[model samples]
Target: MTMRTFASMAKPGVTSALPLKEIPGSYGLPLVDSLVDRFDYFVTEGAENFFKTRIQKYKSTVLRVNMPPGPPIVSDPRVIMLLDAKTFPTLFDLTKVDKRDVLTGAYMPSTDFTGGYRTAVYQDPSEKTHGKLKAFCFEVLKMSRPRIFPEFTKAFDELSVEVEKEFENEGKASFSDKVDDLIFNFLCRALIGADPVAPGPASLGNSGPTHLKTWLAPQLAPIASSGILPKVLDELTIHTITLPFALVSRDYKKLYDFVDTRGSALLDVAQNEMGLQRDEACHDLLFHIGFNAFGGMFILFPSIVKYIAKAGQDLQREIAKEVRGAVEANGGLNMKALESMPLLRSVVYEVLRMDPPVPLQYARARKDFMVESYDAQYEIKEGELLGGYQPLATKDSHVFANAEEFVPGRFLGEEGEKLLEYVLWSNGRETDESTVDNKQCAGKDIVPMVARLLVAHLFLRYDSFAVDESSSSAIFTQLTKAS
Candidate 1:
């Protein structure tokens, strides 16, 4: 697999909707605010290049290169930098093209994030990029279906009870809203197993961790994405040099405190429920269901809902295929019941492929590496870094054939295995080009399991809509209806 170039994506109408990569709100936010612009460009243009393994231009942005692309390693630390003397030129040097770091402008959160919600662009060694992505897709994605409506919405719970404990009036006020209640309901059940005020599942009375997890996600978002803003960072005059850092230190300590407190309870409940007998990454029904369903899950729900809604009739039909079959035979649904639906599984996979919650990954370059096949030097020198995007890779015509068409069987049939390895979340086998193993589902055969089951149950048995990208721009509504 040679390095994929975005130019290859120019297959017909490949880049026609490429501009969507520019703004977060789809049609809004027209300017490049910061380093994120570079990533948008890569995805827009390089999306087609994902077909092969090489990275290519996705879109050309107004956010031009102020400094030439530098070693990929230096930019890796671009996450939390003090834009002082060192940061000024260092950022420039990091962007210099001379360095192995394919500096464009893509990043994934590194501070402390769970799951695969952060996005970034990475410099790559062509084929290896594909391999690394295969490993990720398998490992991260769920094996089953989503927790669909009816059952998901049925079991009632006094939602946001724990959070209500934290902010008091604030929590009550916020939770009163429909969407807020929905997010809280999904999270509460997923976390404690019982929705205290609502229904069953039994609870361990663990509110400490539950509440902390609630506030942690949004609180950390601002710092991670835009870090202490320019004014805040600049406020620290000479005398306060160590002061802000001290406050930050305190905040850091608080995070540990919160994690330890909440994580401990979660660990116990999660371990007990899963009947864990060995050391694992805490990925059981408790953690998996809780984290994605409740905990830190709200981040991407809005966008996903829109996408699903936009898919409209096609989405409904696909949902029916997965859900309908199960209802006709297996009665209702559970993890196993959802497994019967393949179309549901495939469609979910394609949805993720096109609009990954994180788009790209942020990993600093370990060292300057070369794309052995392309024979091009991709400097990953120390202090430099790179990010890899699955969107650009998945949309590549070179790999996906039609590329943009949402053909459900796009990943099915003969070449299924080949595309499977292309997913950014999974642990598939490694193989060289030519006689490469086409491990269908790219090892991410699992990620969609829960969602599949949940959706299948809804599509087949209950009444609910799909989560396509075309729903509505109001990302928040997706969260609102989960209840």
Candidate 2:
């Protein structure tokens, strides 16, 4: 529980150096070690197996592995990965580690996506700018909270019809692709206070939602396929490569224009009320609503639906009953009704624990610090990059019984409340509060509401559902209505 500092542990002026062993891990080769191997393992073995394999091999919760080197590419060549739930809390302590170094890790593009690091995601806790931006985000979310259920309900109705049409025509509906558009439109309506579609004619090509996805996919593609571009080239030309797309790509241009026009009122609130510049406010909105919130929802909603389907009919019936009862008792699918469903909350937490969209977290040590594992303590030096693989930590056998299996009501009661801290899927600990200085997700409170609404709508409309599990995609089929 206590941190052993060098000055405190050593005699004064002697500059005592504690023998810090590199957490046991294979760096592979010179320069290009383990990067491809790690990426392949993640994609093939799945995130759970990827971390489990390494933890078993190293026999330690902490490890140092060589990643594709550079600032904007990977955090560092020798990155430390923490796997134990006991050690997970250290990753959230911003007093010891600096999050601003590379919040997105090495794959984060060097484009001015935030209008010159003006967004809360890119700022350190100590910066005044972070506080202002954080306040702006919180205020916007407060205003939008009342609208989340209604907005998401509308989107889900549209999505349900779309799915039914596809199933009627083709015998199966690709829920993965359909959910992306559904969540994107829902997030836009709730967060940006704008319509999710472009203002112009349908003949003008793809809608605003399509354009937004087209632009974001390539930027995020590097994470799955590392080493796509050399570190040196990425450093020099990332902004050059990214900036021009906005100017040249018709889809990017249309998306940008639509967001700017539709989100002008929100931007003005940030500028006039919150003290941000017009352009900075616009860019921040895009980063917050488009990238952060949209990316998380895109993966989360589908995962929730897939798991519920996999959980079988009895559990699905229970969830549907809870949703129906809550709506009837409350007179509608409001935030209060969603919050009242303990079983739904447990299901969402379990889904996040098992398959977090963002499995890895990256931070840099601001100063020399000490971290302890289940067995031993290690000294981490300044500038060293640290990572926490969430799936492994959340599923630690020491914490959860039957760690690998999905239990639908695992977190339903007061006893389950204590286990909430182990849910590290949101880029921050469940116990951690979102603040200007901390790295907890700004949308942490809203994400659950969004997920609950999606679940409520799905169960309300369909009595039971089945998924096409043969492929990686989560397609829907065999939808049955209530008897």
Q: Tell me how many residue pairs clash in candidate 2.
A: 3
lDDT of 2 by residue, 1-483 (tens): 223344343233443344444568876774455555444344456455666777788878888764433323543456787888877767788878887746656445555434455466766787767777777788789878777777888888888888899999998888887887687777777877666564542221336567666667556544443334654443345422334344425665555565677777777888889897777666776778777888788888888889998899999999989988998999888767888789988999899988887877888888886776777667788888888877788888999999989998988788898888888876787767787667788888778767877888888888999998775668987788665
The per-prediction tally of clashing pairs is 95, 3
Global lDDT of model 1: 0.35
What TM-score, over all chains together, does every model reach?
Answer: 0.48, 0.87
Residues 354-464, candidate 1: write the lDDT tens digits.
665444333333433321111111222443343344455456554577776666655566676467555443212112221112222322333355345434533433233
Once all C-alphas are superposed, what RMSD does model 2 give against the true structure?
4.9
User: Which candidate ranks first by TM-score, i.e. highest?
Assistant: 2
lDDT of 2 at 468: 84
In the predicted model 2, the residue pairs found to clash are 73-106, 74-106, 125-437
Model 2 — which ten-residue stretch has the worst lDDT? 239-248
